[model samples]
Target chain A: MVYLHDGSFEGILSGIYKMFHAKAKIDEGKLYEASVYQQSFFELTLNVETERENAHRVASSIYESFGHEGFKYVYYAYLAEDDSYGTLLFRSLKQAYKIGHQAFDALGVEDIRLLTQMANKVSRESHLLLGLLRFVKLENGIYYAPFEPTQNVISILAQHFEERLADQVWVIHDTKRGIGAFYDKTQYHLAPLNSFESLQYARDEVAFQSLWKDYVKHIAIEARRNLPLQRQHMPKKYWQFLTEMK
Target chain B: MEIYEKLRILADAAKYDVSCSSSGHQRGNANKQLGSTAAAGICHSWSEDGRCISLLKILYTNQCIYNCAYCVNRSSNDVKRAAFTPEEVVSLTINFYRRNYIEGLFLSSGIIKSPNHTMEQLIEVVKKLRTREGFNGYIHLKGIPGADESLINEAGLYVDRMSYNLELPTTKGLRLLAPDKERKQIIMPMQQVRDQMIAHRDMKKHLKSTPSFIPAGQSTQMIVGATDETDYHIIKIAEAMYRRLALKRVYYSAFVPGSTHPAVVERGRPPLNREHRIYQADWLLRFYGFKADEILTPDQPQLDLLLDPKCQWALNHMAYFPMEVNRVSYGALLRIPGIGVTSARRIVNARRFSALAYDDLKGIGVVLKRAKYFITCNGKYCGDGDVEPVYLRQKLLEPPKPEQLTLYQTHPEVFDESEATIRGLLT
Candidate 1:
């Protein structure tokens, strides 16, 4: 049986809480977008309200079975925003919980190692995006930027950019999940920027674009010309909004 | 502060000095500090040049007294110059660090006023970072060539790493191009720091309370292709730096052809592949148990610009190839062109489990393309068993002739004898 829950981290947690309370040994892979799973199997559209107490218990269970770091490992991996990560994380957490805290120490084992490695990948990707995110100066004296990060770490990235560009009003739109953060001098939040494309990007965006393009061209030396090396360092897919490319 | 303008200028100037590896100092935030530096090093970001920008790699000042002809920020260049106050640098380091943008600082500077004066400013920046700011991050401070030994020692106490760039590779090149600087002016200060570090370790062994100097050790940068000094000369200097001074690294910066010095060859820059080959050669000397003289001689001193130093060495000594993968010694496995430290270790470990098959060689991380040319699996020749040195070399050189390769594949042509013969014809 497959359980379709609202695509929210808390909602997914609540589903896990319900499964545990119901004593259901449902496979982690059972959750699908309705098309892929077996048709005759039981399907539940879970609307379990996100209980703080249940979330805490679930977190506590993982910590008790693993450790404090293990809890954070699962949390950040969940924050990775990849749907596939959910099943992998769930399976790992379930297996670890079943075996207790001793299983956490067996990190060299492949299954547990995979989760730890995934967590590290998400953490590193989040850190790299901190420097790579390009902010364009908008016409209204605001800085606007967009990113399609593979992990749900846009908020963590926004905090650093916000501090660095504190003087300006800006918005960073995470185009993939339609969520973003807007900072107007003193405040910021992860809000739905669904209509961000229509929301006018400032006029000076063109000037900043030219400046960055000029910077990249002049800085990349011809004597040490290595485009394949450059691509290996900064992949081409990242060039769409990087002012250096345009 | 005008330091912002200076920061851009000096940081840009310091960018090409490639000794910026930030490994080997791991300290945790012990005093309730917000962040800590790792011993294995951390790369926060890579710059547009595709080089890792882990530290705040900037010059304390670009104001130099020495006019090194190959340097862009040579005193003669009428460029916008700037200097950072020690306080300003401290704040910038902390602010950038708090935001997790950088691991720490890589503070180098031109000879601002005098070597002692410049060394003082460098020391002051680190003093404030370590003592005043409560910062325990990895700092790599460049020692001024003519700085006072005491000042250099003081600077060493606060920094994680220190370097004095041997701007040109050879003494003759140093005289012809960078006339104002002498070889001793650089090496003397490095020797002082290294001796002090060793003395500190000895003191610590006796007196438990003794402090260390530059825990990550010292590294130096040599500007490649700036003078007539060949790869053999460059690697010789590197080996000397490691053996004599105990330098942790010897960075090779490929000279960009902007200098109008008469001694410089202006027809075309020495290929980046040449610099890459030198670095590979340097690694072989430092870690892979090869000597500078063994890699190249004064007669055949320059590295073959097409094949890596290891592969080039392997080619010259073809009798060592086709060794049994399961039985070859760890040191011998490292000499194989396709085998690295990682694969060598894997081969050593996996051999205990089972006699490795041809398929198992792939799992052990051998470059099948390169290793097949060198090794045999259980006496089964994976590559052409006869190992014609001419035919083998051609296959290796053909891949990147259309487009240049990375620092890793710098001298792809050096891999094959036929390619070398072809190139000799064209030249």
Candidate 2:
């Protein structure tokens, strides 16, 4: 059935919950049935509004039957946010309900395989940003890091630095999404950040940046300098924010 | 000297080091410390030379008493010299770490007055970083070759990883290139650190309060192509180090020509290809269960410049060709040229549901371009034409040779500043 949910996580889940019991409850609603599993069709599209209640039921079904591993795949895929990602969540959730945990290992299935790839792409970005994301100390003793990650991975990056850099107050701004994560030494919270104001660097920031640039230059072995390999690890899209690249 | 000059000189002195890994410790921010070590490690940046800038890799000082000819900081050379105070190193590590420019600090030093004194100077920095600053980040300390055992052990308690460079592969290479360092002098501290790590593991089993002893274990590096050591010799040494000493890693650094010392060799270009081939074999030894003798023999003492060790082995043993992927054991699946650890595991897992075909292989992560030469699907051979070794060898292409490009990270005049004319290669 074509059950279109609002693109939110809860809406996606509500859509999946309605799809699973399509034959019974979905027939009376404004929804229209489509082929399930392995290439779904859209004869009709019905927006799902039973969001929170249905979202809770599907989430518990995933946790109870397939364990946390299956939910990780769904959540990361959701974060990846492709154009038809909602339909992907619905199809993979159907896989979880039918085959239970085996759905994860069933890489032969196209939807499951794509979900795995999307989740992996999200994870790879999260891991890369852990190192690539640079923080510039502002004039007021606040460390602010600005980045443009393709995937919505602020949650992952925030949790890592919150524990790793526990004693400092910092802000991680996702400029592309207009959102920011603010951590106040003890805890962190996320809020909308449409645009950023021009901030001055700390007094010693320029001197340290010069020292850092020299270190990066001198540490490279002249015999093995391969810019292609360096670019392969640190791509062109993320160069504007890097202190060394600048 | 200013921190700028000190950093430039010390970092240039330390660039020959190939150990840039910052992993192996899961130490967290205890009592709300300034930093924590990630278990898988993180690379904060990559230099233009295409190597990882994981840590603030630098030397405490570039002033050396012993003249190691292959080293730029050798006493015989008149290069610029500088050193950082213990306070300077602590502050640099904290500031760079806070800016997310580096994961931690990799501190090594030239023998200041003596081996014990240099080791002590290195330890004092880490001691302050850990205790005073409450830094729980990754640390890779250089273990002075002939330092006292007590000092080496105590340094282990403060750092996550320790390494003593086996500067040259064989004793003959040490005599030829770095005459001041003896093979035994380097091995002593490595052995001491290994024994301490073993004792720490056993002690921790009984008492939970036992502090970590180099929880990342010990790793070593050797200069390749500077002297005429065979790939066979280097691989065997690395294999023995892993088996006997329980070392975590062994790095191979291609010698870069940057000194005027008479002992330095390979004046034209670094033998990066030879270094690359040896690393290919090193991975096979560490993960692929291949022995040193299996990779290279006295009959063919060097690795093939064109073929990888695994593909070379596969070509040699054609009897194992055209193996059915679905039926083969996981070990055999790994032996195939295109199937890696991940692809092999995927094939094994996916086959449980149904047999994989050539199309399924690509999705599951097999390099069909290479694997099609050796593997079969569903009792059908998908290899192009006959799987003859000679034809397959011709089909494989090689990477760009090193002679085409120069490693001029800066302009060529960067060398003119030193005026330390390396022999005929770069005149």
Candidate 3:
């Protein structure tokens, strides 16, 4: 059986309704697939538009059993592009209903622990990106940086970068999701940044980078030539966008 | 010229002096400053060497008179030299602070012309930041040895904290390594600073709201493994400093064998693990009420790289183990291998309502693996059956001594799974 639905919260809820009606087992499939969760034994349903009541019923039921913390985990996991997250979310909700608050203790068990750990890890990476991600300030003084992050944490990252580099108008485009956040004057918003190349940056960027590179170079004492030590401190991955590396 | 030039030179020179912790100071807003110093848990940063960069730590000048072999800024090293006038530093500090770049300044210097000359310049920077700039930010200044007592006293009044680095552990180490520096030059200034602080406190008892003078207290740095000095000798010196001088901290920096001086050991840098273990030992001495001789002996001059200082000591004295958790006194609570000050307090607080079982011990954040061998729950031993003293010692120390990773965190990957486990050992 396959349940194909539009990539929306309502559509996913409608699919959940079908699964409940048939009492079908959930299976993993590529999220981007037009037809996903297909199995040979059960009937395949193509559900597109979702009723508002059906989506609300599914969300409220999970919320009733586990309170707010459990709902937040479910919503975040749903938003995560991985299809396996949806199955884990379903299993966690079903188990929580079975055991009540004791199920909340089970939420701290290894499987959910991995999910929280991954979320936390992604959150930390995004925060670091906000600080360390360098923008090539263009001739017109528009600062821009495009990064491909493994986690969909660009939205969280955008807030911190917007606060820190407040004086300038900048753009942090997430290449993985083909979306970007823009901070112009006071307001900030997320919008599609389709054109990856031909992006402009501030003119004095090269000069500033030269000075920064020279600064880091002068500080590194040659007598302590611990490449292993240096690699341990600053990883090769971060060196890609660093001014000194260029 | 530009502030960047001064920062590049001054900060680079200051990196050598490993005493930039914005820690153990408590204060609220007084005059016109923006932030207050915290009592504990101030964040530290990492240099290229991966050391914690807690402050905008910098030298007043790299120019020197005394040539200490263990110091990079010794008189003979043919390195580029620079000096920051007091006003120059004040401007840089204000600018960096405004940019949210640093918590405060950690000012140290080479002995330029004389110790008094260096101390005066260092004093001038703290004074200007305090009175002229109205900067109430956390400032940790290094007191130059052999400087005028009055000069050191005045410097202490303006700075949040001050330190005198005992570069070598022993007097014999001092004579051999740093010929010009005497043991008295370092200890004398610390004594003067302590005397001034005590006198200031005494006057404050009568006067309501007497001004703060070095409210964070004084600290000192000891260069570990620099000479033939053992960990026993190094920790002994630190224990004495903590007890006699009332020092707030005694930082142990592993000798990095890069000093250009002819006298320094060119072969092996001190195992970073040894320095880490010494810090763990130092913590036990301060908070756990453990004595230096109790932690280590001259015969066993080195700390076990595998087990922590407390764990090693507990292994050595297993007859004292299986102390009943419910009835053990607070003094005995401190003696348990895995029980820190926090966990001991937790046990005391939690046991007031209910008797703590083996499970409840975990709730109080005790490591069951280590603590099980030492503590008894409801007067029953939960440790391994083969709990002989020698066997326990071997068990505690046999865990593969994970490689020593430097505490200097410059990048993210320095914390790969294996290295992060090692990093935990060092911090």
After superposition on all C-alphas, the RMSD of every candidate to the true structure, in Å, is: 8.1, 5.1, 10.7
- Window of ten residues with lowest summed lDDT in model 2 chain B: B416-425
Q: What DockQ does predicted model 2 obtain? A: 0.71
lDDT of 3 by residue, B119-196 (tens): 888888888887877676689988888889889778877888898888888899999988998999889888988888
Q: Isolated chain A: TM-score per model?
A: 0.76, 0.87, 0.71
| Chain B TM-scores of the candidates | 0.91, 0.92, 0.89
State the lDDT of candidate 2 residue by residue for B1-427, as single tens digits.
Answer: 7888898999998988899899988987757768888889999899988889999999999888889988888998999989999999999999999999999999999988999999999999999998899898899999888789999988999999999999888998898877778889999888888888989899999999999899999999998878887888899999999999899999998888777677676467888888898999998888787899988888888999888888898988989888999999998998888778889888888888788888988886678877888888998888888578888887654545677456465466767755556545476
Task: Return the top candidate by TM-score.
Answer: 2
Evaluate fnat for each of the predicted models and list the values in order. 0.11, 0.80, 0.06
Query: Which CAPRI level is candidate 1?
Result: incorrect
Task: Estimate, for each residue in A101-142, the C-alpha lDDT of model 2 and write its tens digit.
Answer: 667777877778888899999999999999999999999999
In TM-score terms, candidate 1 sits at 0.71
User: Which 10-residue window of candidate 1 chain B scores lowest in summed lDDT?
Assistant: B28-37
At residue B241, give the lDDT of candidate 2: 94
lDDT of 1 by residue, A23-55 (tens): 655363344322333455355444456676786
* Regions more than 4 Å wrong, model 2: A23-42, B399-427
Better of 1 and 2 by lDDT: 2
Model 3 local distance difference test score: 0.70
By DockQ, the best candidate is 2
Q: Individual DockQ of the candidates?
A: 0.12, 0.71, 0.06
